[model samples]
Target: MAISPFRIYDIASTFLQHSLHLTSTLHFYARSKNEYSHGIIYVRRLSMNLNDYLLNKHLLLVDDEQELLDMVVSILNEYGFYNITTAKSIKDAIEATQKLRPELAILDVMLPDGNGFELMKQIKQYSDCPILFLTACGEDEDKFKGFGLGADDYIVKPFLPKELTFRIMAILRRSYKSENPIVKLKNSQIDFSSAQVIKNNEHIQLTAKEYDLLSALYRNAGCIVTIDALCEATWGANPFGYENSLMAHIRRIREKIELNPSQPVSLITVKGLGYKLIVE
Candidate 1:
C-alpha cells in the first residue's frame, strides 16, 4: 500500500505526541511506500534525545531556495544542531566542503548553476560524507540517479519538520556508528552509553543537563569550549541567560567526574573563557 506524504505526516505527528508523556525513550518505527516506490521509509519518533551525542556534527545544506534554507535551518536549530553551513549554489557548496568537511550533506536537486547530482560528485572528491537529497524532484529517474551516485537518502520537498529531523538523525546514526561511547578521565571514566561515571569502582549517574554539558565538553576535549558554545549545547538554540544555570551544572558535573571539585585536575575552567575536559 502506498502512503501519501500527508498520511506519513499524520502518523509521525501522532507518535511524536504520544512519545512525550513517557519517561523512558521509545522507538516508534513506521514503514511506508511513496510514489517513487522507495522501499521501507523509516520514520522514527525523536524521543531518545540523541542530540547530546550527535549535535556537534558538521552539516552542509545546499539549496537554491532561500526561504526553504531558512526554514530547514530553523528546524535543525530547534533540534540542537548548531554546526550547520548553508550554500545557495554548487560553487559555494563545493567551496564550503573543501574548506571544512561536513559529516553529512543535504542537497537540493535543482540549483541555479548546477544540479545537486553534480554537486554530490564534486563533494565526493573531498569527503565521503553521507548525502541526503532534499529536493523538489520526485521523479523515479531522479531518485535512481541520486542513489546510483551514492546518495544516502532522498526526501521530496514540502516535507514535515519532524520527518526531516528524524531522517537526518537516522542518517547520522548509520554513518557515524563508530563513535566510542566511553570517555576516560584522570579519576573517572564516563560511559555515555549508560550515562554513568565509574569512579573508583563506584557508579555515579549523571543528570540530563550534566550529560549534555559533559558530552559537549568531551567533543572538544583538551580545547577550550567557549561558554556560549557550552550553553547552546546544553540549553538550546537561544542560550542567553543560561550562564548561571550552566555554572551550576558544571559544578555538579565536577563533583561527579573530579576527585576534588574544588582543586580540579580533570575538568578545568579557563576563568574568562570556558571549561576543558582533561581525559586520560
Candidate 2:
C-alpha cells in the first residue's frame, strides 16, 4: 500500500523521533526532583502525540548472553516498542516465536545446545516474519552462510547500536514492500520474494545485504563482473577509495558458494584484479 520511499522514511523517522523524545523525557524526569519529578504529564502527552503514529509491530530477540540480550531489549524499548521479548537459548527462542508470533526476530548464530540457524529453519515452517542475525562471527563465509540460509539482515558483533537500529528499520521496510522476491544461484534457490532460501528443500534466513550481493553475482554468472561492477549494482554507486566494501561483499559471497572462502570455487577472485562467477 506504500509506494514512496520518502513516505516510508518519514514514517520511520517519526517513529524514531517520538521514541527518542519519550526516552529522553522519561530519563530526564527520573533524574529530576521537586514538582517536575511528576512529569508524567509530558510523558503521557508525548505518548498521546505518538498514538496515531504507532505501528502495531512486535519484535523478538534471541541471544545466549544475558547482557547483550538486555542491551538490545533496552534499545528497542527506547525506540517506542512496548511489545518486546528476549530468549537466551534456542529452545526458549522457539517457544517465544510460537507464542508471541512477533513481526520481526533478531537472532544470534551460535546458541547454547543448538544453533540459531537450525531454529530459523523451523520458524520458517509457520512464520514468514523477517529475521536479522546479530552474531559475533564477522567472517565473510559466516555472513554468506547466514544469508544463504535466508536471513533478512546480518550485523556482526561489536557493532554500533545506531547502525543496528538503522538496519532493523531498513529490513522492516523491505519486508512490507511486497512479498519478498527470491534470488537464484547455481544449485540454490533464494526467495527474496519470501525472505527465504532453499537448498535441498531446506530453507534458511539471510541478511538484506547478503541477499543483494548474492543476487548480483547470480544474475551475472560466469561474467567477469568487476568489483566496481558489483559495487554499483548492489550499493547504487561506487564510492571512490572505498574498495574495501566491495572486497567485503565478495568475501561474504564466497563463504556461501565456496567450500572454503579463503580458496573459493564458484566465486573466484581475479587476483590483483576484480572477480567473476563460475556457475557449474
Candidate 3:
C-alpha cells in the first residue's frame, strides 16, 4: 500500500524527536503525496565514520528561522560535521560564502532578504559547491525551479535528520568521489580504488592482503588499530595465528609506502599493540 505523506511525516517526526532527541519545538511540515512523487525520502546505510575525511568539509546552511538553523546545526554536529556556518538571510549567506567557500550548502527557498534560488546563483558565482534545497516550499514548480538552477538536491522541510544527512552525504560522495579515494602520505600515496601506491612517480601494486591491511590502517589513520582488529580486517573471522603473517605484510607495505622501510615513519608500529598510518 502506498503510504500517505502525512503518515510518512508522522513516522519521521517521531523518529527525529525520540530517536534523535531533537527538541519538541522542531516543527515538521508535510506536502501532499503528489508533491512527493519526485522522490524526497532518502535513507541509506552510510559506510562512513566519525573520522571520515568528508566530515571535515565546510558546510553553509541558510535558513530564516533561527530555531530551525540551530536544530539543523546541532543534528549535523552530532553526525560528525564540525565546520558549519549558518545564516538567516541571503546577505549573510553570500558574505559567509565569500569568506569561506563551503564544500556543500543547504538552503531554504524563502529567505527574508531574498529566496534560495537567487542565493544559489550568487554562491555559484563564488564557488561551485553542491547545493540542497531544504524548505517549506514543496510545490512542483519550486522543485523544478531549484533543480533547473543546477541545485544538486531538493529536500522539503520538516525532514528526518537522517534523510537530510543522507542526501548531503550522497551529494558530497557524488561530487567528491574522485578525490576521496587517494590517501596521501608523507612520502607516498595509496589509491584504494586502484589498489596501488604511488611513490617516486611509480605505481606499486598491493597484494590483496596488503591492500586490506593498509585500507584498515588508513581508515583509522593516526590511531592504533589492535593486532586482533588488523587480523580480522585482513583475515577472516577465525583470525587466530596471523600475527607473524600480519607483521610480514606490514614490512612489505612499509617498503612500498615508507621513505626508509627499515625505519618506517608513515606506518609506525605501536610497540606490542598494533600499527598506525600517518597521512600527509
lDDT of each: 0.76, 0.60, 0.75
Query: Candidate 1: where are CA atoms >4 Å away?
Result: 1-49, 181-213, 218-280
- For residue 218, model 2's alpha carbon misses the true position, in angstroms, by 43
Error of 3 at 152 (Å): 0.6
Candidate that beats the other on TM-score, 1 or 2, i.e. the better one:
1
- Residue 259 Cα positional deviation in candidate 1, in Å, after optimal superposition: 18
Each prediction's RMSD over C-alphas, in Å, is 12.9, 20.5, 12.7
Which should have the higher lDDT, number 1 or number 2? 1
Error of 2 at 271 (Å): 73
User: Model 3, poorest ten-residue lDDT window?
Assistant: 37-46
Off by over 4 Å in 3: 1-127, 136-145, 160-180, 222-224, 270-273
Candidate 1 residue lDDT tens string, 1-280: 6544312221214445454442222222123322111222322222235565676677898988888887787677556565567888999889889887888999999999989999999999999999999999999999999999999999997899899989999998888788857888999999998999999899999999898888767765555566776777777657789999989998999899888899999999888767778886
Q: In candidate 3, which residue pairs clash?
A: none
Tell me, by lDDT, which candidate is best: 1
- Candidate 2 lDDT, 78-150, residue by residue in tens: 5544345677787777777787687888898899868878878977876899889999988899888889989
> How close to the true structure is residue 147 of candidate 1, measured as C-alpha lDDT?
98
Measured by TM-score, how close is model 1 to the native structure? 0.57
